[model samples]
Target: MFDFVRKHTRLLQFVLVLLIFPSFVFFGIQGYSRFTGGEATAVAKVDGHDITRAEWDAAQRDQVERLRRQMPGLDPKFLDTPEMRLQVLDGLVRERTMLAAADKLHLVTTDDRLQRIFATDPQFAQLRNADGSVSKEFLAAQGMSSVQFAQRLRQELSMRQVLQGITATAVGPAGSSGTALDALLQQREIQLQRFEPKDYLAKVSPSDADIEAYYKNPVHAAEFEAPEQADIEYLVLDLEALKKDIKVPEEDLKKYYTENEARYSTPAERRASHILVKAEKSLPEAERAKAREKAEKLLAEVKKAPGSFAELARKNSDDPGSKERGGDLDFFGRGAMVKPFEDAAFGLKPGEISGVVESDFGFHIIQVTAARGGDKKSYEEVRAGIEDEIRKQLAQRKFSEVAVEFTNTVYEQSDSLKPAADKFKLELRTASAVKRAPQPGATGPLASTKFLDALFGNEAVRNKRNTEAVETGPNQMVSGRIVKHEPARQRALAEVKAQVRDRVAAEQAAALARKVGEARLAELSKAPETALPGATLTISRAQTRDLPREVVDATLRANADKLPAVEGVDLGAQGYAVVRLLKVLPRDPATGDMARLQQQYAQAWADAESQAYFASLKTRLGARTTEAAAAAASSPAAN
Candidate 1:
């Protein structure tokens, strides 16, 4: 074969092209694109730049992480929805559009402005130093250098500047704000006759024939079918298992302890009291001088009558937080206060008063009440913790090596997961009836979608072979095989008859209620003075009066220019609602605060203008979002 191919290299090459080119033309490009971060994955475009799938996925993960942090008790699955993911993409598009606009508008944040914002913004308090400087140490802790932090801050400033003009200056048209607020708060006296399905359920008796026919309906098959599932035996190669195998040398642990000795010691703290006078560095020199003189007088009083320091601080201190506590800054560790204040507090011994000291916040007179801590735990006392830490570090480093060996063993052995599990000392875990998607409350490797997907892959299912080691999470790899596969099957009608009967009954009941409600509505239309049979209450968007939201909306939306207007609302499965609007009343004054409403209206007006301006910017900059990248993005901003 080699001799023949060598002698006819050109001919062989031609034959190969003839055999492969068609496949390449049909499948190669598409198969390749799916893996690349180019056109195939672009969710949006801004200035002809593609926002790829990788970026969108990363943004969504970050968004989920942030939301998880903000609301720790909320289910992560709720936040990781298709709608929220698409919305995140929408946000990315809007962000990209703003960046493009800012670039075109030559909007660059000035260094001075950046410094001022970092120094004065309460949001950046954690990143601000004692002298109103950027905290390099804090930035380093966040893995951002000062230069990178400055760049990130500048980008944020620029993005803000793009929309700042419209949002900052927009004003609602005269009476527009009041008109909107009044409409929202407008109350209507309503007589609600709700035909709830539950109330009418007794009226519905679905025949067996009807139930059987409904169950047999093709549209309802999915709800009746048991999803395809499998029994799987999965082996996980993870840091936890590796840690059990790790043997840490005591000398190495001692070395780690010495290097991180600060971790073993309790940080020193000082209890102090101070009287501060408002004297920001940005204040005029004379004003600052006056503040210093005032602080000096307070210091003099403290020195003359040490016991009266707290009394003077309570009366004379401008620091609202501490002043209410008699200027007592309860025990705080180093780096908790400004450099000058900390120095003054720490320099004084117990019951000693310090001279006036200046800081970015103001001039302060300090009185140190007490000092404590600075205790160190011996090596033996913290030995176990240090050894565990060392083991984890070593295991982390060893994970990649073990994962590769584990991968090879799983694939080479192919038929079973036992070899890999035994080799890695991993538990041979078995899960029955595991579906492709993680079940609710699923945990560990079974909860990982990647592992489930690989387990259910065609090759793994058909051949009963182990899946390729899939990375389920950080330092976690899993390979699973199908022990038994169950294809999706329809349940017998007898099996789900009770549920089917109830569903059919509810649906029929709902339909009947709507029909009767509509008939009642027609009679009310003909006879405006017809008395309603159900509850009579005043309702508005602001106060629903315990009525169904549909009834409230129907009542509010009824043509109020003509009194005694009648409307019918179909409430789907809940049933129907008929609202008779007796009269349109003035917006209730007590239901909502007019001042707050006005402020909210003004804010909304500004937001709408900002969004409108952003849309215009998108048009000019050739920024566009793919339909798939947006779900509820078109919802009215103010509403």
Candidate 2:
């Protein structure tokens, strides 16, 4: 029943499945469905806490917005489906489950730590000036307050930390390293003797009666159904017709270049070095105070001897990433460092030492090594870029105007391509010898459901007229007038005689092979030793890769279970195979190979452990999720 549901569920499409869940209906009646003008629905209940419909909807909107931003031209209707809604709900449920488990374990982020993380974030820092101050205009433009954005960052970071801790605790150590993976990688050389089906082909031939009998079989008849089709003429309006109409005046181009000159300029940059003292909110106050004093001492030394800043940094800096290189950060433009750190670094002259600066990472003693000014690029260097932008903008505007006119002219003229072509002075193009199925030239636009429906629609074909203009791309539209239509008919039997004969012969050969195999099996059952003329059944431990390369994949899957003592099994297109399992290898843990396996399977083992841990946690917390939620989370429309 589940398999059948999976097959037919796809036919409902992404949008319908997301929006039409049974849970939604249930919540609607109870006045708990937020999306349908009621109180928030409870998608899941984790440890007595409700995962509300409002939260699920917000998550879904966030996922959709992210995808829309990444893929600018994607259809918005794709997200409004039932399937997508269900997928979003399912994901929210899982997240809620994880959060519940984290809470039980007392895993959480403090307010101070969250504040430090936000202050250090590069994206947030971009909203500040060179003097370490936030710009109100930039904050407004991004549609977020400092406090609101900080809270969001904290939630995301806390969830990440909790998930990492869970996974780490679940995956302990690699226990199957020595025997399992090592023995699998080792090669075993062997000789092969193949029983080719083509070798037996010359000995088998079917009579006329055999062919007729095979064709009469219900299974064989079912395989020979005719292809379904539709025939009609369609009118198309294409934007390519407006390409020649677009023009970029010299005055406009010059004006645009002059007005946006700063957009093409670059910013000044600086090089600096620093000594860092690592500190975290989780550390004791006493320990943190000690770390701060150490940073102050380093700052004092650097201030007294500015030229020796690099030497002091190399000796005292706790940041391993930059300490080895004398804490040199290399050249950076504006907004490259944390607010407090960047402000101190940029304010200093070359070879000048700064007072202790505090950031999320810890305290920093900065030294300005050098500075470089910005330069304007040559006009010739940026001319090609400017021209390309102008071309696209002008082309879109011109195409939109001309397309509307073309659509109007086609509708007002006689019901044929000739009249529309003459009225608009268009060179009429024809699709010669086109078919119903997808083909080159007309296939792309014609393959759409709406376009195909319009083609076979009464007004566009029987009455003959232009179609309403259809938008295919940004500022691009198309309209077409039908010129001709052809009806479909079946070909005579004589024309398809060769195809029928080949099909009949293929069926006969397969049946004959099966019969021979059955007869051999009957004899083997009576006397197992007499199954083969001289060959004896060999038993040995083997892996999937050790099997004959030329063996049919279907034969392996079908006969694998009937092993250790099987005889004369038909292998379909590969004749037959006999099998046996001699011995089983137990896993070994202590060896050099175990070290390699531990390194290689570390990620896979971690994922397996994580899944097991999640399942165990769900059971412990008595977590229950609706079918609708699971479906919503897995749907393609959710993202």
Best by lDDT: 1
Candidate 1 lDDT for residue 102: 70
What TM-score would you give candidate 1 relative to the actual structure?
0.59
List residue ranges in candidate 1 displaced over 4 A.
1-96, 103-115, 130-133, 138-152, 199-218, 235-408, 420-429, 441-443, 468-478, 489-499, 561-565, 583-592, 625-639
Q: Candidate 2 overall Cα lDDT vs. reference?
A: 0.57
Total backbone collisions, model 2: 20
Candidate 1 lDDT over 1-639, as tens digits, reads 233333444543422222211111212211222222465556677777777665666666665654554455565656777777767766776766766677667788788997888777766664467888766654443344566556656666777888898899988765898778766898888887888888889998999999999999999999899999998888878888898978888888889889999999999899998898989999999999989988888788888888888899999999999998989989999999988888878777888888888999888888888999889999999999998888888898898888889989999999988878887899998889999889999998888876777888889988999999998777888898998999899999989999999999999999999998889888898997888977668777888877777777778777778777889999999889888888788898776677877888889999988878888888887777666455423321111
Give residue 106's error in model 1 in angstroms: 4.7
> How much is 308 displaced in model 2, in angstroms?
50
Clashes of each: 0, 20
Q: What TM-score do all the candidates reach, one by one?
A: 0.59, 0.51
Give the lowest summed-lDDT range of ten residues in model 1.
20-29
**lDDT, each prediction:** 0.78, 0.57
Q: Give the alpha carbon lDDT tens digit for every residue of 469-564 in model 2.
A: 666556645455456665554444445445656665555555566666566556555654332433332212233344553222222332333233
